[model samples]
Target chain A: MRLSTKFSDTIHLLAFLQVYSDIKLTSAVIAASIQTSPVVVRRLVGALKNAGFIDNDPKNHNPRIAIDPKDITLLDIYLITEGHTPLFVIDKETNPLCRVGGNIQPVLTNIYGEAEQAALTVLNSKTMQDIIDSLIVHNKVKQAKEKSDLAQDA
Target chain B: MRLSTKFSDTIHLLAFLQVYSDIKLTSAVIAASIQTSPVVVRRLVGALKNAGFIDNDPKNHNPRIAIDPKDITLLDIYLITEGHTPLFVIDKETNPLCRVGGNIQPVLTNIYGEAEQAALTVLNSKTMQDIIDSLIVHNKVKQAKEKSDLAQDA
Candidate 1:
């Protein structure tokens, strides 16, 4: 099954907001940071705003994270961005004449629902702060390695 | 986050195989039953066959379920179809200059991995038999409702 990068992109957006909470972020600035277009950033920003994840004023056009990063989980971001859609979509035009085709949608829907709930349970265990903390550690490690490489070169 | 229908289609294909195990099923027949093209059916069938979920004879081109339906979990099917890929894909070209963009991939990857494992836990609790039983029940209910409606019309 092909998975989209929207989920990752959303997280990146949120982490950026959290890390740079002091700065007023614009769509163009976010677009440049995420290596995406301003239109894409605006669309996601709109969704996040609508979902109460972020607050944006039309007059100001600057977006800020509304909820506490520690209070938000990846599951929350997923639900906000993707809505309540199942992880896998069933074909709407499956052949009804065939027994499996006729009955599989509901059965699979139930199964997918359970799987999603399970995934949410895991995601809920982690807060956005957890993600930010890891990112900080990762950046520090990379910086340390870069410094070591420069010292060797000298 | 658009989802692919491959997972549901795969389950439909497998359920059909179990229900009609006595019959020699061809890709065309399966495609017709699943309301998909022969090429699509062949692709999924090939994947399943390679993953040891089904067996196919090259000369005859007849496919049969290689594993007991009761032994095949949705998690197994998910793993086979998706391999070790996370449910969410991380963008490799995210802006490296941005602190969050540079480090978010690994953090999100770790979170996604945990979420997938949790989802697998739920999927593992269910077997092909569970799906088949649900399908059988669904079919019977639909048939009964149809019969009742017909009797009322008469």
Candidate 2:
């Protein structure tokens, strides 16, 4: 029903780093925010490091975003997390006698690839700066609403 | 690692019906081409029927496209098969103490939705007729290559 949350989690990790730039965080701390275990955080952190997006030290859990938040797109995160996997998977084994079965793979491959590319293109347009800004804006609005609600209660 | 293959299989099923309109096929036969079981075939067939893309009867294994192939887009088929499932999933549970964790969902909901819409837009541009055409063309090329190879052997 759902795809992996790694892409979103990766974004969350990076966004947290940007928002709390002054704070040093261990996998345990990041994992709490992601609602996952420290192990998962380390794995994702390792992946981001390999992709040259972040720098980490063994002695310190603190991570620095090597690339600007505005510079990183969801597509970049996706490429690191999902790794060019097909959006649609075809059934490989087919009755060879069926002419359509024998030749449908390549056709679907092209079509599905285009659709996946379209999704990636949309992701490419979004930067981590957009995410961090939206988070800040939404929280401000939420806080304002809560203050208003509390005044009405009083 | 991969999302559901239902979308691709749905396309495959419809393509088979279009290519072999003259042949009446039971689930067993369709399953053979799909390399899946008859039960899986029936389930998919039911989905297609419910989506108003196909008409089938218990007495007759013959199913008709019910709509023009060109008129049916991949988005239509996707809506039927996959039903607007989020392409990216966000982790819901987050540490309340972490400001980023407390408010990341809405931001992601917006971002993920846009990316999914992008994919659907591309799929909407494509039709079953396009798939059928590609299948026909690829088969011709493949057959031609086989013949040329045989001639060289002779």
lDDT of 1 by residue, B59-91 (tens): 455687788889999888877766556666778
Runs with alpha carbons beyond 4 Å of true place in candidate 2:
A57-61, B57-61
> By DockQ thresholds, what CAPRI class is model 2?
medium
Candidate 1 deviant stretches above 4 angstroms: A1-3, A56-62, B56-62
lDDT of 1 by residue, A110-130 (tens): 888888888888988888889
TM-score of 2: 0.93
lDDT values for all models: 0.82, 0.84
DockQ of 1: 0.66
Please give, for residues A21-71, the per-residue lDDT of candidate 2 as tens digits.
676787887888888999999999899998899986445557878898889
Comparing chain B with the reference, what is the TM-score for each candidate?
0.85, 0.92
Clashes of 1: 0
CAPRI rating of model 1: medium
The two-chain DockQ for each candidate, comma-separated, is 0.66, 0.71
